[model samples]
Target: MQLGDISVNFVELVREACHKLNVDPMPVLNEYGVTPETLASPKARISISRFMRIGQALISTANQPALGLFMGQALRISHMGLSGYAAMTSPNLERAIRLWIHYESLSSVNKRGSSRFYLTEESGVAQFYSISPYNEFNYFVVDCLLSGWSALAHWITGQERLLKEVEIEFEAPPYAQHYQQAFNCPVKFGRSRNALIFRKEALLLPSIYANPATHSEIVSICNRELTTLVGATSLTERVKQIITPMLQGREVGLTETAKQLGLSEWTLQRRLKKEGVQFQQVLDETRKQIAETYLKATDLTIGEIAYLLGFSSPAAFHRAFKRWFGVNPKPFKDQHASGRTDENTATGENT
Candidate 1:
């Protein structure tokens, strides 16, 4: 799946980790505009830059170069929400990891790359690797991710996971001793990759929470959420996310959308072009989709719906709706209002 922005809950976890170290997270939270409301809601997102600023603040405040390592050790299964539940309820550690990896994006924004587990039978080792983007938070992101994986495994099986060795891509930090304490294993820095090496046999351990029936049910929910999140990962979906709310208030344009996404208008255009979509095309489609939903489901007037959709006037909305559906709005509403049960008339075009 394509990587994109992260969930605000991960930022909340970072703040929780900071609090564990007796660090006050407010100053940085205020500076970056991450409000209590943002942290309170798991579905909210913090842009990549804002997330890095939080990491920077935690490190600066705690004066711990190995803050990420300490933070990783602080992870709890409950912090991951549905994904955590799905993982723990899996039949075995290996299946649990698969569940975790599939829905991990529900926990964090994964812009650099998605995570994966690799099993090497020859060495009887399973490797967990996180692709780190080339940013200041690269090490911090990977540290928390890998360590959190180890932490989750330990929590699920109620057993200690003595990693074979922990390999890090970055040079050893000044407080490197913390790595050994965090991972409870030898740590190697300046390695070719960042991965946690462990015995493959660990994958066979039965989870105390495992229930095949429950797992199957929760898996369906996870898959649905995965589809939604994956859609939000695309450039077009990102734009629509921004445009949807903006439309309720005022006209949303490319410049404003690009600004919210932290990209120059042209850069956003180029990327969308690569995906074979135009910015206006995305905006119009979004408006049309919402317009149709409002027309069908709500008793709101045509003028009210037009205004809510950011159209300057009902006439303009009429022209656009006709262009999209090849019919006027009044007749469409009248069909539904008159108790006409024909699917074609209710759909506004098929008739």
Candidate 2:
């Protein structure tokens, strides 16, 4: 149910990956039931299920060089940056996933921090995972995890494909054929976890271009920037992360949130200031998201929604929502409610 943060251009990543595969990825993407257009919107998210189907398919069919080399090429790293370089300096393929997860945002402003790789063991198989925080663009996470790692493994051993199995956590859908193609291995769904399985020998593959110097440098840089990328994990990210969550609730306030995070009022304020945000401003932004989420998704009365947001009065909520989105709650809700349900928005997707 998660992809990296909500901002990454997942469709672009898919397109780039497809480009690397030397086939129009759109056809495959469409086969898995996603349109290139739907994912084009910055705030838009694909349900996790759809994302997995596409990912499974790609991993089954795609070659290793396509996953990294072409994906790197698709992102235009030659002039702008290095997808391969980032993947190369890591200690292992898992570290390489983190590099893509960390520096991914550098290449795409929409890239967020939710996509991550982890390991799991079930039924005696080594499962490497890519997880998402919510349901949006879940396929992107699945695709990247399967294909990206497969690509990295290939790079290490100079092989074509690396995964023994792709263990998907979600239920299998209609795209089994395509799924088989992308992963090029047994694909199972509704499993305990989402992962790629490799034989024990896979881990022993030496990185084709391991470098201690570059590895150290990238790790240092990744550490500093990753803290910021989390945007809600550390003091910096905490402010960003809590902004939307706190706003949606009725009891938002500086002192309350400071207490919740186990910090004194002054300390929280100082930290947020360093991150270029103030308590009141962050509070307003939070309220705006809360206001929008409630307005669009619920039938609660204006008075109730306002009260739920810690607004002293409905009028204040209305005024604030207007400033945040140019239109007030009622109209915003009305417009969204009237629109087709083809695209369901993420309640707390943030930059």
Candidate 3:
């Protein structure tokens, strides 16, 4: 995989934007080598830099201010390869999101389960929310997701109701104003989260093709991408990024995990594979070793250790630890302390 490929996936949004705006924007995608042919395939995955390039094209062409409008109009079913799958397998807008949450990352390996699209009923209104929290490619993720959220709204209902609001945590700047009309709704910035909101009734709307076999094919394709995602350095970098922060609540994404080292994520993956190890195995093995070291050499609580290893809960940590060492952490800690006492007593007698 190359940056060009990843960029290509994101370019789908730009491509649609150009079409909706009636602007010929081929040169932007062409500059990065994202072709119509490459995009037609749902399983094709690409690189980060190329996606950035495509984003630049939109930023330039749409005028930085109108970027959101360009983006909002760009998101659609045809772009996500969900034309058949979203309609059939999902049963409704809600179920379709469940599939999308699990499978949407497959459209481009760039996201890899770091985003969301849903309708939340709260505060006297049903709200639609879309998010991309786990991505290193924030600009690309936000742009792609905002557009997809907008597109999904149209797909769910023939009405083409725009998003209720789009919120981002980034600094409020010249880039913020353009999104206002794109949503044909409200937009908020410098907020606590990055997400898009809409009405709840949108969940009941369905897309064009609701067929089973085609949906299964889409599932199969996305599954393969998910499997390939494992052991890749991208996975390793994410683990390290998340783990480092959980340990210190410091900037974990800042240090290169051998994945964050490059402008292109695929390059990091290739480099790791050349080194004879996949990111997933390295992450798991590293965590297990670290957990053991923490258990034996430190007095940190089990909860802290679990969080340090990036597990969501202590039970998860214990299970993983047992699987790795064949012993629970409490017993392991006790045994280490006992050994330390024996050695200390022996040293005292010698003295």
TM-score of each model, in listed order: 0.63, 0.50, 0.54
Lowest summed lDDT over 10 consecutive residues: which window, candidate 1?
342-351
Report the C-alpha lDDT of model 1 over 45-109, residue by residue, as the tens digit.
65544465578667888887676776678887777778888998998888887778768667654
**Residue-by-residue lDDT tens digits, candidate 2, 1-351:** 121222224545756777655656767666644565555544455533334445545655564322422342234223223444666765665555546655654433221123344454521233334232323224445544455556556665565546767777766654455666566778887776666676555555556677889878766775676566456445644554444434432656788778867899999999889878888887666566546655654345677677756677788888877878888777777887774232232433221
lDDT of 2: 0.54
Candidate 1: Cα lDDT at 183: 86
For model 3, what is the error of residue 134's alpha carbon versus the real structure, in angstroms, after optimal superposition?
15
- How well does candidate 2 match the true structure, expressed as C-alpha RMSD? 9.9
Better of 1 and 2 by TM-score: 1
> Which is the leading candidate under TM-score?
1
Model 2 residue 50 distance off true place after TM-score fit, in angstroms: 17
Find the number of clashing residue pairs for candidate 2: 29
Report RMSD for candidate 3.
Answer: 17.1
Model 1 earns a TM-score of 0.63
Any runs in candidate 3 off by more than 4 Å, and if so which? 1-7, 19-23, 35-42, 61-65, 82-84, 87-89, 110-113, 117-141, 159-164, 175-178, 205-351
Rank ordering of all candidates by TM-score, starting from the highest: 1, 3, 2
Lowest lDDT 10-mer window, candidate 2?
Answer: 342-351
lDDT value, candidate 1, whole model: 0.71
lDDT by candidate, in order shown: 0.71, 0.54, 0.54
